[model samples]
Target: MKKAIGLFLLTINILLMSCANANQIKKGDMLFKITFAQGFSNDTLSLCLNSCRIVYNRILSSDNTSDGITDLQISVFKKNDSFSAKIFQGKEISCQADIRETIKIEIVLNGSSQSFTIDTKQGAYLSIEKNGNDLSLRQTKEQVLYD
Candidate 1:
C-alpha cells in the first residue's frame, strides 16, 4: 500500500509540472479588421485612391519567440496627425496604440523586427495594429461577406 501511494503521488506531480510548463510557453494569435468610410464633408473631390487589405499572424511557441513582450507598441499616422485607440484584450495588456488615416496604413510587430505597409482609399482609411506578450486575438478566419 505504501509503494502504491508513492507512485500515485509521483504521477500527479509530473502531470502538474507538465501543465505549468505548457502555460509558460503559451501560443496565441490575433486578427485585425478594418473598415473605412468617407467622413461627412462638402468637398466633392475624386482622388486617385488605392485600397488594399492584408492580414498578419505570429506564433510564439518557445521562450525565444516570447522575447517580443517588451517592445510591443502600436502607432498610427494620418495626414501628418496623430490619433489613439484601445486594442487590448483587458487591463493586463502591456501597451496599445491606434491611428486613423486618410491615406495609408503601416504595421510593426514583434518589436518592429517585422513590418508592413499598406495604402488605402484616398478619401477614407482603416487599420488595426496588434502587439503583445500573449496571442489572445488572432485572425482565425476571414471572409469577405460583401464588396
Candidate 2:
C-alpha cells in the first residue's frame, strides 16, 4: 500500500512541475516585464503589457515550428520575483546575451534586429531573442495565431 501511495505522490509531483514549466508566459502577471510604451506612462505600459502577454501565451502554448526544419527556441527561467524568456528561431548565435528583466519585447518576423531602449522602473521590456528589435505595441496584433 505504501508503495502505491509513493507512486501516486511521485506522479502528482511530476504533473505539477510539468504544468508550472509549460506556463512560461502568464497573462496579467505583473511579475514578468514587457514594456509597450516608454517613459512613465502607465496607460502605455498596461496596453503593451496585456497585448504582448496574449501573444506570448499563444506562443508558449505549443511547440512552434517553422519551415518544417527550424523551430522556435524558448528558454525560460526565473530569479527572485522575476521571470524571463529567450524566444527565437532560425540559427542560434554564439554571442547571445542573457536577458532577465522587465523590457519591451520586439517581435521581429523578418530576421532583422532593431534596437531601442525604454528608461523605466515599473517593469523591464520584453523582447524576442534576436528576431525582434523594432517592434511596436500594435505589432503583437500582427503575430500569427496558430490553430
Candidate 3:
C-alpha cells in the first residue's frame, strides 16, 4: 500500500513538471500572413523589420502562373519588449517584437521601394498586392473560426 502511494505521488509530480514546462514554451501572440499575388516573374521582395540595419530580401516567383500564389507567415513573440527579425524560406519564421514600438516595413518590389509602419500591439495580418506597376500594403484583423 505504501509503495503504491509513493508511485502515484511520483507520477503526479512528473505530470506537474511537464505542465509547467509546456507553459514556458508559448506560441507567438502575433501572426503576420504575407501573400504575394500571382504574375511575379523573378521580382524582389525586401523586408526590414524593426530596424533598417539588417534587411531580409526574397526573390518572388510564380511556379505556375495560373494558380501560383505565394504566402509567407511570420509569427511574432513578445518577450521583455525587445524585437529582432530573421528570414526563413518555405516555413514560418518566429521573431520577437516590442508591442509599444512601431515596426518599420520596407519593401522593394518590382524596382520600386515603399515603406510602411505597423503597430503590433493588437497583432496584425498584412497583405501585399501588386497591380500592374504599383504595390499596395494592407493590414486587416485576423478572423478565428472554430469548427
Candidate 4:
C-alpha cells in the first residue's frame, strides 16, 4: 500500500537526519577534563572560560568535611567564529571563550586563595594537587588504552 511505503520513507529520513546531527563537530570545539588529585577539602572551585563562569563547586563542613569532587569534564563549542558559545555538561549553558584567551581557575580554601590559568589552545587534561601549603596545577596527557 502507498501508505505503508510512505511511512517507511519517512522513518528512513529521520534516521539519516539523526545520524548527521550526532556526528557533527564544529570548528573551535574543545573538551577539557579537570582532576583534583589530592588534598582537596572544604574548598571552593570555580572554572571560567574567558570571563564566563561555567562550573562552580563548593564543599562546606556540613556537607562532607572529608572529600570533594575528584573529577570534572567540560565540553566547549565555539559559535560561528565568535567569542561566545555554549558549554555542555548535563545541559547546555551560554558561555564565552576566545581561542587566544586562557581559561581561568580560582580556588579558595582555608582562608587562602589560589589562581591558575590553562591555555585553551593547549592540551585537554589538567591536574590540581595540593601539598602542605603549596598548590600546583599542571596540564596532563590523557592515558591511551589499546585492545
Q: Tens digits of per-residue lDDT for model 1 on 1-147? A: 999999999999999999888733122211223321112112111111112222233321222223223112222223223232222331122212333333334332343333233332222223222323211222223322221
Q: Candidate 4 clash total?
A: 0
lDDT to native, each model: 0.30, 0.35, 0.58, 0.58
Which candidate leads in TM-score?
3
How close to the true structure is residue 52 of candidate 1, measured as C-alpha lDDT?
Answer: 23
Give the range where candidate 3 is weakest over 10 consecutive residues by summed lDDT.
Answer: 84-93
Deviation of model 4 at 27, angstroms: 9.8
**3 against 4, candidate with superior TM-score:** 3
lDDT (tens digit, per residue) of candidate 4 on 39-91: 66565655555666665664422223234434444455555543343333454
- Runs in model 1 with CA error above 4 Å? 26-147
Residue clash pairs of candidate 1: 29-137, 29-138, 30-137, 30-138, 30-139, 31-138, 31-139
> Per-residue lDDT for 50-116 in model 2, tens only?
1233122222211133322123333333434444444443221121233334344334233333344
TM-score of each: 0.21, 0.24, 0.59, 0.57
lDDT of 2 at 82: 44
Query: Could you give the C-alpha RMSD of every candidate to the true structure, in order shown?
Result: 17.3, 12.6, 5.6, 5.5
Distance from true location, Cα of 124 in model 1, Å? 37
**How well does candidate 1 match the true structure in TM-score terms?**
0.21
Alpha-carbon lDDT of model 3: 0.58
